[model samples]
Target: MSQTRFRARTRIVFSLLALSVMAAPAAAQTIVSTYTPLDLENCRHTAGKAEEDSGVWRCAGFGGIPVHVTANDMRMYVSYGGNAKNEPAARETLASFHGEGTSIEWRSERAANGKLKPFATILRFRTSVADGDKTVPGQVLVVTRLAPGPVCRVGYVDGRANPDANALARKIADERARNFRCGTDKAVVEGATGPGFSPPAE
Candidate 1:
């Protein structure tokens, strides 16, 4: 190749490298931060209407995905990571899930260790495609904890937080919401809605 052409190509390559380096920091900030960390803070005091408690801990949909809270003095909800559609699917799968748990499996793949907390259990679990899905991506690692009774759940959600972990977290949050049912204990957790929760301040 011509020396001049080679020089120009080298310049382009160096420019791209520089741009990539610059972009990495910003990308990391947003993607590597907490999952709805804001919710964790706000759930300290925020009231949602009669929340449609989805599942798990049952908080009446008071907490969004990956939300940490001592909401209504009920269980804190935290999602593994991911968008809304992620959780419902997992619930369905788990409901009829004759196979192994996708999230637990993925987490185990990258797990170097695990720890337990009060109402919170942190373990290395898969958050991505299952073992048989060859077309899917690699395994994911997720660590999470759930605190029962008017506690705040706070944690970092790496950009690549596991899909299963994300979905499962949502499932847990939904359950927690229902449990917080302000008026009745039929489907309630300690600090949640039943008689325990007081609608948080706006």
Candidate 2:
């Protein structure tokens, strides 16, 4: 082959290879199974009339700490209530439900990488247990994701426990938030393509 012709052929081959690479599908991310805390042993799941489109399971025998997971599979509960509007509206709706003394700590309606994301709220507060005037620190995380439909949200609340117990509860909540699968969802932001609830470090 002529040198110029050979160089042209090489360029064509490299171009094809580049195109093929670009056309290849990205590798799928491995999602681990749901995390079950050791504390929840022989706990009875709450049973009651469930909505045709949604379901909830509350597991509570874990040493006085209750863990609940709710799944919404349809468009019935997609909106954050009120006018069924956007993220700000949703945040307003959520804010209405805060306990009398609860304070809003942080929120991320927009994903980290600057994209319009589903509403997510993180709150911290102190709660007092019954019997006496003993109070303990607590954190509640609520995240809403738009996909597959109903915009599944995982609400986790933990309080009135020892340091180790608090750690375990936080871990369970973090894992639950992490491994949840909603639908063919894209990263609301550039970085977090999935649920971005990173439980606060103990």
Candidate 3:
């Protein structure tokens, strides 16, 4: 080939390669899972009004975040942050007539500063399914987002219906938690839902 023709071809090839490199997708961020135990039995309780019949507990959360759990009537509500500004409203409740488990699974990502930033949490709630005249045990996994205004529930998985409830919960957290909008966005419920497995009225 002629010298000029070869030089022109080489320039075009290099330009194409450079453009391709620029258009390539960046590496995805790494996400991780860490666990923190919730001990309602051991946490300090804060007294509320008699009519409310509420018991509140402040528990240790991953990465210095504070977990606030409140039990009112027969239902439980959870919030996370450093103070009241980052917590959910007093009327917020994740489930109806359900009790929560003692363990909390925190889904976080490592920041550039080598700190863990928690984005979501997974907690199990015990519900009841009516059978005959008695009630049988049922479980629901609640996935809650940690930020974007007063951490709120992002999704729920029916443990009895989904064999991989934990995996689904984590998937929901990783996919939806960071961008989930509290109050405005509705929490998603996956798998078969009935009676105690259904989403809360709130």
- Choose the strongest candidate by lDDT: 3
- Per-structure clash totals for the candidates: 42, 1, 0
lDDT of 1 by residue, 68-186 (tens): 22222221233333332232222211111011111221111111232211232222222223244342222222223232332222222221333344555433333343233222322
Best first by lDDT, ranked? 3, 2, 1
The TM-score of candidate 1 is 0.22
Model 3 misplaced regions, further than 4 Å: 1-29, 84-86, 130-132, 194-196
Candidate lDDT values, in order = 0.29, 0.32, 0.78
When sorted by TM-score, best at the front, the candidate numbers are 3, 2, 1
In Å, residue 168's CA in model 1 sits off its true spot by: 27
TM-score of each: 0.22, 0.26, 0.77
Stronger candidate by TM-score (1 vs 2): 2
* Over 4 Å off, model 1: 30-144, 147-202
TM-score of 2: 0.26
Mind giving the per-residue lDDT tens digits that candidate 2 earns over 24-59? 643221211122232213434444356642343334
**Model 3 TM-score relative to the real fold:** 0.77
Q: Which predicted model would earn the best TM-score?
A: 3
Per-candidate alpha-carbon RMSD to the true structure: 17.8, 17.0, 4.9
